[model samples]
Target chain A: MAEQDEDSLIGYDPLAWMHRSDFNQDSRKAEVGESEVDSSTELASSTETASNLEIDLDQAPADASEPYASQGERAVLVLEPVLNIQNVSVLHQHLMQMLSNFEAIDIDASGVTMIDTANLQLLLILKQTAIGLQKSISIDFPSDKFIEASELLGIAEMLEVDQAASGFF
Target chain B: MSARIVAVLNQKGGVGKTTTSVNLTHALAKLGKKITVIDFDPQSHLAVSLGSVDPQKSGIDKVLLEGVSLAEQSIPVRKNLNLVVAGPRLQEIEQLTDGGARRGDLLRRALLDGNRDEDFIFIDCPPSSGVLVANALFAADEILVPMTSDYLALQGLSHLVGTIKKFESALKRPYKFSLVMSRYIPTRRISKEVLSVIQKYFPGQILATAIRETALLAECPSFGKTIFEYRPGCRSARDFMALAEDFLQGRMM
Candidate 1:
């Protein structure tokens, strides 16, 4: 039951708040019931964790560590190898912002040298959100470190990574 | 495999909508197919007949309005049969969804949200065109329209058929419909005449076994029981039991 893994998710489940009508069309946003309440609550609980993540992104001065940057219609969310309590906020913001303007989300996991169960859950949630919004997401460039972390948890399939292409050992 | 979701419906009142839902599901359960009956009718007859549920506690409404899980809301009735009672408040939901898709597929999303292990899921819809009926159509893979033997029932029955067709085309998903001729008075010559007309219209769609008008069916619900529990040896019970067999036979057929 990924219940423990679900709890370790450093951010909110965007599905909890985003209703079917919210993504029906950008022009109209209808109030969804449970998804909205649940997502909002999880988002509220992760505020401190998210803020801490924002601070870490500010401290790291790497070109890839810009955390989030635009790529025309598709947005790139640069995740650190060790998401922990540090860079989850950056990922959450990008997920929440998916409904705003982005047609697709490209998760750049090339720098992700380390990841845990909580981080795996975050990736799953992002995939789920993309499906509900009728949007696309491509994690086509995960590093060897990311693949190793995913394999340790036996969730290579859950992340939808093509093993041969993904170098999944 | 998931449960086969079935909605028993008719636009007209007193067409054995609740009667068939209560008795047929119990009969199906008796045959060893896991069953759950959802009383979506605002009248709450299905709940009252099955017994042990608050008339105002619509289990589906809680799933829709209060974020209550479907499994949590169900109350066990007969062996292998669990019941979800309907409240008068359900009518309010129909009024709300008639205008738009703002809260559409509430039932579909809820029923499909988790693992529903029942072999058959029967929903008794309210007697009209509204959100409640729409929800039933959206969620149901099959529809059972229980109509009385008469020419007057033909138009309303046809309208309901058309509604099912429109839903299938619009949703791009197929839904099967079967007719159960209820309240059949065997001695009446008009009964046969109306049935002949129905046969011409529906052909193989009509169930061969008819629910004859009987005091047992009418009296059982008032006592909060179905035909099988009330009088298992009676003709009414046999008719429904045969119908249940018919349903089961259709499965492998």
Candidate 2:
């Protein structure tokens, strides 16, 4: 739990609130001596700790992180190292933007170290979209992670990739 | 090593079972352990927690009802975490009375048919003792119980224990059982009392780390995010990560 020691953290002691002066120690006896109870809680306590735990759920993407360089009429999309559902929608938005603006798209996936099924599905959709428009969409410099994930999902051929070039083959 | 097939189970509903299932598996996945979580619960809270909102998603029901392979339905949500949502037809399994001996064996058979190469396969079971839960019991080698510190929770634990005992007795095999204390409020007197009561009965069964009660744990699911993604730096996230480490290091009985 080294992350807990970070300076940004507002520390919370779970048992610290029990030491309040108004709390009675005499009424602390257990009513059920040996009887068991059902497990699972609907929610957490509404004690003093609740106020300090405020969170912002409207976490929309701050900026367009998906970078693409225009090469003539083709847009070369450079994928990040880690791609999962967390960032899939942003990448999808960028791909859709690229597809509508350009005639051809080239995905540069050489940097991807981790790719999940959601992103692979996104790329598959991109490939299909490009084919539907009769435009070119090729995965250029596909990383081992990208190729391995595509192969694992049994979509390597659909994405038009030959694993023979990679060490996985 | 073969995958550790665990059923995140409790006969009683709402005791952080789905919360623990989603976060703990995500924590393990972040630690580079390949994990696959199955929504054995008909309510589909596990899938919703992982952000799969589609009611029509193909899932474990297909594998059980139609004999489809488990791996075919896996959706990789995180880097190493794959999810098998409980499809809409999953509830139909509970109403089923035809399979007889084959009913309980559907999940186990489906598991045997697929080779997902996961380090852990966690089944998020519904909070009732039904056929769906029976299927999970047949498939899982271990039962990870998520409990809260309350007398009612203890009663639920006891009933679940009886169910497990019956299975173990009939099957002639013991499950690797462990308990995780969730939504714990150390400041509450009853919480401490309940903890002591549980400790007396299930000695060495409880995990060292207790997930303290926090609003963030309850709020994350609504946003379709785990605690890690919801607030990575929060105490709840830290607790979950430590809990995951505790699980990885075998810090339970």
Candidate 3:
């Protein structure tokens, strides 16, 4: 059964792996206080292995939620992961919690140095949900890399950023 | 002296909004006046054109979105000319207008706090009448509309003028406007007719100087240059310089 699951997830785009590698190199320096794997190599290897497992779609294990994810209604969630982890169940849960409470969500990623395909997909999913429910969701202060990633994906318009109010974050 | 805020706005894209902002700021700077150019457009083309700084690296979006101080993000473009670069993160700032308190005044407060040492501030408004433009109008003392010589340009001028009037009534402040003829071709009869019609409607609000249609203005940005820097003696550059001088001498009135 494990083999069947592994086989099903095998051809996951190799480009994703490349993105993960580039993201790790770019973001590893700022992942402090967010992940136990301090070294860039360790963070990359651990995330790759976790991604290979293709964890179930249900809630992520409590240990996985550690620093990148928080269960708060109005609190600002900071995702400072060093590498790109394929499953962003923790991030999705954070957005769902914000939706349930009808609270404005502000994601502060100023400390983030890199992001992978999983992180990008998580943002898209959150944005889509916010639009569908007509809820006010905002990605507070994203770093340059985060902005570049959004522009690359052609979703820069959806972010709804106001450059003037940036000083308050 | 009270700082003057002028917004270079035209709803229609490619109508010389950015060009006017960049050149006007430079022209004003040449007069020994301290000027700050705010690139309110998320596209960040103004920053690239004047400062040669990448918007992503400058963090102007942070100042607007996270309350980052303008002093921290303001990049010096040239002597007496400073730039507040816009980045992709501005998209988040636009969404803050969910029926909030003083949505239009947020930019006004930011500019007031940021512009301590400046004499004049020029805002390059985006090509839409969204909240960003509203914030700019709330902060500005005067609005300058740059229009090309076309029938569609007249449509844009009417809508923008109406919007400005509405803003003036709501804010209970006098909103002054001047329409500038841009990309004008001398031999075109339609251009002349459009100019006559605008003058009939706006009367004395039209500036005397018209920016002749030229390719130099469009090509300068790709080379990380302004027309003044690329070809100071060229007709386009000289015309813009003259316009800047006329503006300072209060010739627009």
Candidate 4:
């Protein structure tokens, strides 16, 4: 038994071991354990470095110097690409948040590709809120889907899209 | 059994669409059919005329927006007739016309799942060819077009028929279209002539019973009751009852 064990150990070739060492080294970073250090200063410093790296990478492009290229114009709050009852609460919260910033809320629904009853209700609430605030808010660029949906739901007059917005008091 | 959806539509305003919807619903209920009337009209005159409900308090707007169950929003007006009252949020419901699940079929889906044990469902469509009207058209298996005897009435009928045809083509489902003459004065020669024209153009589509011009029909809305409840002996009540019988029996011609 002892002789057999010695022979098996020797059969593990040294040349094969040398070849496998490079593969192990390549995986060393992935095998690292979490650091025990909890210092706020170190964490802050690391975060600052990461942010700086991000900014540096972002600024590398020559077009970054263009006025609207880096920061981008303040994105207009538009209807979500999809509108349904499942996410209606989220849309409502989003609309409320948008309304908090500007007295006059203009939603660009051009991006909305789909809608349901729940989303329709959100639009209604937004309109009611605007009415209560006595501010002018408008929904713009209604797609064919929007027009067809409005006609079916029987609230076409309520959507303050371009045609109707002109008459909004 | 699939729920029977009846849509009351008239593009011409003040042609008694609401009145017909509310009264027929009541009449149908009296004949032992469980009925749910969905007032898709933003104006919500049907809710007011039937239940004396204030449009603001109807809460239908929330149902449409929040996915509230129809049972929760529906108000029971009588033994067999229930109402899903219209809400003020109708002012903005149009904005939802874009993409969504059950976009055109929202009301239909709601009513099917509403579980009211109703055999018949009536949708009171708005005056215009808007989303509400589309919803009604999409939901209904049968459509009742109310008209008066006038030149514009004929024009309105043509427009409504065109709309129905479009809906049928889009949905790929056939609908039973019936004409109900309202404010019909039998003595007037023009009224008789127009009725004949309607009969000729729409053979077997006109109901035998026509609602005559009666002040009682107009007055009952103020009292928040159907002609049956308000004045059962009145001519309007008789006409509606006969119309209801004709409707249930499928004998309109």
Candidate 5:
């Protein structure tokens, strides 16, 4: 099966998405935030708030929920394969736990073969908050599906952008 | 006090537009030109090439659309090179429908008001002609078209020129531009023939520097560095240096 997968990628260039370089018509009017600058101040506060939470990665939740595993200052938060709004709350909870309990974050995303903007937005905010708190955030053992979703969303940086896998087809 | 806005443009993909944008910015900075490269392409390869942007950071698109200042969006890549990354929010440009004329002037307004000290601004355009490219064409003082020696890529010139002409006619002014022959395979006979063909069509418009195809271009991006910082001894460096000098001297060669 692995052999078949590898063979299928022959002549399949991974960085080929770099070529879809087209500007859309009337894109200048994109609607969203009205602030001229990014919401850095809000993101900073949100990050700090997340860090200040007393939730422990290894601590058992009040209900039957996922647990975070700690590895010496770096707490690991593995994500589920699908990360839409339906599952975003659980991921968000674990994310908060990791942020609050650890000085550094090592996210294991091998199981996160799928993701959505809310999850990515959460990660983006978490990374920003980690930066403000002088904490480190890195993706541990990123899966192919994880990398693809990140690239599709143009948030590869959130994955810490796997260099070796950057061109994976 | 004024930065000369140059849009590195071409409608074709994989022809080294991002490579040229990042390296040329590096080369100009080496020659003491205060420069900023706006990764206008939503793919954000310019940021990847130079390792300039943080994954969580929003790009210049925020400035262009949301009223963010250049100072807020710009990241210092080196001594004189500042970079404005293209964030995922920029992908929103494809579907935008509200602001029209204000949007057209957003980049020009940003460059005019926000960036007064830089000597040059390089906008790395995407491969397809769209609203983003239109904005770039409207804002740029000059356009640099990077094309491979392949014939299919050559077919894009008419469309590109036509687009630019439309911009010029609408804006009631001309946008100066040049052709950059990228990924040139020196040993390939087609490369030389295409070079002559381009020269024949637009005399004295092609930059003298021809970027040779090399593994270094692909390798540097993986390391999140420019050709200058990654493998300075490579020919890619030499080509960009020559291109920069030629640019400064008007590539009088």
Candidate 6:
């Protein structure tokens, strides 16, 4: 019985409701003969409208072309098991300092078991800063928690989450 | 017969929306009725009260957000009782500004096929008149309002009735509206006055069994147990059984 039920859901798309509006917008854009809209630009527009975010990206060091870690040349930051509201501020401050010194930072998020909007916003700010400074920011071994949260907010593409990195594939 | 969908709603916070949903649904299920309780509230308090603490669990949020089969997301919590925890990112629905009328009707559409086998489907709604509550209102035929005996509660009740009435007028159908007196303190004169006031306006609408306030009732959720599981043979358990019985008899309209 369970197998039958599972089979019934073979082609079901859970996020279809979220895309209905986007589909309409896309069709309207197509009707007007507009160029294909870049999803990253659309994500940036959505983020710009989010007045609730506390992260001020304007103050981020724009010219981050040098590596700052005095501890080591290959600065790999291992994330904690839980990156939620409780530690978002400290993580934000740490990422901000890292962005100022490191031209490229590798974040090991394999241990993140819990994540929320605050932490996701903090990471997005770091990503946007890297893009502006022409620096590189890569998330390695993204945990299911991080991926689910980013996808839930419709920011997985913006976060550049490689779902294949989960190794469940 | 298909399940009678009920939305356990009260715009006022701390009025026992979770308590009534968890206990009343459990009581009914214990009485041999097939029941499904959806933790429609983004806070997911009903799921937590039932001992499913993992917020990552895909639940009614998956049903509403992703259109997943409700049956697929249901977690069997008790005999004849299935629970669907509010999945992660449910709060994002409240922040949504798009979808127009489609967003409000998501729950109603999601339950179309999955609730056919259940005898009762209860949705524990959030404590605010937002899109989530609107979805609950749209999906449910009955509105089970758990009210407390106090002036502020009375004020909140009036606003909730107005919201329900607006929906009824818009849909051109009256809901099977019922009120459950929660956190009752019979020793207090104010309780009697408040009950009398509610009775004067909504006579025969309040259930006869008043769930008196108790610390044990409050403590059960912390242990992830319902009243029946927490204190199987206690006063609160008896009160909830009576409330379930009253509900079964259709004593309140």
- The candidates' DockQ values read 0.01, 0.01, 0.01, 0.01, 0.01, 0.01
- Scored against the true structure, residue B49 in model 6 reaches a CA lDDT of 94
- TM-score of chain B, candidates 1 onward in order: 0.94, 0.97, 0.94, 0.94, 0.95, 0.97
CAPRI classification of candidate 2: incorrect
Residue A6 CA displacement from its true place in model 5, Å = 44
| lDDT (10s digit) by residue, model 6, range A72-160 | 12234657776677667767766776677555565667567888899888888899987787555766546767778889998887887
Model 1: residues with Cα > 4 Å off, grouped in runs: A1-169, B97-99, B251-253
Per-candidate RMSD, Å: 20.4, 24.5, 18.8, 26.0, 19.4, 19.2
List model 4 lDDT by residue over A134-161, tens digit each. Answer: 4335554466667567768887678745
Please state what fraction of the native interface contacts candidate 5 reproduces. 0.00
lDDT of 2 by residue, B1-253 (tens): 5688999999888798999999999999999999999998888999999999999887999988888888889999999999999998999987665544477678888888644589999999998776777778878899999999876887677557645644553344568889999999999766876686567556788888999999999999998999999999899999999999999897863
Tell me the spans in candidate 4 whose CA falls farther than 4 Å from its real position.
A1-169, B100-102
C-alpha local distance difference test of each model = 0.67, 0.72, 0.64, 0.65, 0.67, 0.72
Instruction: Identify the superior model by TM-score, candidate 1 or candidate 4.
Output: 4
**Candidate 3 C-alpha lDDT tens digits along A1-169:** 0021342322222112112222232233222332332221211133323221111112123464332222222333455544366446645654565566433355665555677767777777787887676444666545556666777877766764422122222
Per-model fnat list: 0.00, 0.00, 0.00, 0.00, 0.00, 0.00
How well is each residue in A74-102 modelled by candidate 1, as lDDT tens digits?
Answer: 44455654677565656566567643555
lDDT of 3 by residue, B104-169 (tens): 566787776733788888889999766677778878988889989876776666556545643553
Per-residue alpha-carbon lDDT of candidate 1 for residues B1-253, written as tens digits (9 for 90 to 100): 7888999988788999999998999999999989988989887888999875566565878887677888988888888999987755776776551323435477887888667789989999988765677778778999998989765676576446545544553454556768888999979866776676567556688887888999888999888888988998899999999899987776211
- Residue A68, model 3, lDDT: 25
